[model samples]
Target: MNKRVLRIYFLISIVGLLAVYFFWPKYEKLPILETVSSFQLENVHGGTYSLNNEKIKLVTFFYTHCPDICPMTMMDLMKLQAQLQKEGIFGNKVELVAISLDPENDTPKVIKRYSEGFSADPLGWKWLRGSEGDTKEIANSLKMQYQKLEGDFFSHSTTMFLLDDENNIRALYDMAISDNPIDTTKILEDISILIEGY
Candidate 1:
């Protein structure tokens, strides 16, 4: 009877350990898709922002006057910004970049107001605008296509990029899905993997 009880307890312990290992959040080391081309643009705060940095970055492209997709993406990012802030990594270990596709219209003042509308913190979230040619160059490198439509509108790709500290494109997340625009939980897990140097 004593031996049977000990075996049963050992089996239960093994099952519990296996459950934890399989069910607990696991962050795999993300692959380096490609190195991003270094670019510099004007931040909304009147400062120059560069892609060369020693911090993880989430990069997206948008225009202040975007009708639907851009605004929705920003909303999702605002939620992500809060999570990163709560984790105490925002602005320090991780940064968010939103580059303007409509640089002509998204001037410093315009972009600043847009950022404010989303409650984007300048310390961690950067709203950048540059010349049309420069903006196209960066967008092309990221495989983000955009075409100007009539009267302050654009048809653009709704993809968000995740970059490691070394400016390597690590992952791409879709922002066009209506049901789930951004997977904050998955992003946070990936960020943790990068932060842990996995």
Candidate 2:
């Protein structure tokens, strides 16, 4: 090609490389929801909670009627809980809060029953809910979008976010695909890393 064209191409290549290098996705998050309000909800066990004062926790969203996707996601969460329990903070510092997407149907009673089905322990895990508007606002803030399907079903992403003691979303665990479940091992690794960092 011509000299001018070659120089332009080289400049573009350098710019592209710089963009890719600088704009790459970060492996470690720097507290995205740094100042989000401390959310309040009623637990299936009939207790009140706010994320601000809660311990280090795993938080996920699901509905009682979600047959395929949510159930799988819950199983993965349970596995992570189990792993955490085996390591000993199952009761002291670790908590799993699964918020309901279907607030209309997932009342305190329904959430309690659902938690039972998932082998949820009241001391460690919670099936939580709030008003429809309240849930929508919280989900929007977290970027956990969902849409109602036919027969009042729902389609939503299967992501469990880990929150530290400060209520920041420390890690996002995407567990929709079967081949790649939430990395409990990595999550635990991060928890330790963060704890050390603090």
Candidate 3:
């Protein structure tokens, strides 16, 4: 081809590529790490709670007494829940589960009190506690770590995991760390996309 013709074709190709990149509808697909199917625990009401594949779930580990991250994480999720509710996607499409890492100290009553302090909607969110061994196993399966500290204190990672309707781990949010605040908006945007898929 002539140089002029080749240059024209290259320009057209670049425009086409830019159009596709800019105008295409992008749906983010989160990879499935593993299926979470087996877990039984006690809810804040002291009722039996089980994890299954029925609903898209947001799971996080926290202890009622966590000095900072735990409360901040849940409060952030509280805002997320409110946003989802405003969009009418809170309960029918998604649910949130906050599991107590210090189950020995975070009894059903303490879980209830802590959740209420955050104004958590119990109908849409659940606070859970179980035996220390069972809770550790559950955390292990989710790849979250927590260690006992001095005098009813604990050190734990701050992570929130998103599970699909089939109970597959789809995404995770590091809600908080030692020095940074959690990005709840991005997490909610991702959850909105997932809910849209359902």
CA RMSD of each candidate after superposition? 5.7, 8.7, 4.4
Quote each prediction's TM-score: 0.84, 0.78, 0.81
Residue lDDT tens for model 2, 97-182: 88899989887887787777777777778778899899999888788888988897998877778788777777788865665666
Q: Mind giving the per-residue lDDT tens digits that candidate 3 earns over 1-198? A: 999999999999999999998889765577678877578888886567777737778998888778888877777788888987897867777888888888777878778888888888876787888888998889888888889999999988777888987788888888766667678677777776677673
Identify the leading candidate in terms of TM-score. 1
Give the winner by lDDT: 1 or 3. 1
Indicate which candidate wins on lDDT: 1
Candidate 2, superposed: residue stretches over 4 Å from native: 1-33
* TM-score (C-alpha, index-matched) for candidate 1: 0.84
Error of 1 at 155 (Å): 0.6
- Please identify which of the two predictions, 1 or 2, would achieve the higher TM-score against the true structure: 1
- How accurate locally, in lDDT, is each candidate? 0.90, 0.79, 0.81
Pick out the ten consecutive residues of candidate 1 with the lowest summed lDDT: 174-183
lDDT of prediction 2: 0.79
Ranking by TM-score: 1, 3, 2
lDDT of 1 by residue, 1-198 (tens): 699999999999999999999998675569889999788999988779988988999999999888788888899999999999999999999999999999888889999999999999999999999999999999989988999989989998888999999999998998845656788999999999899986
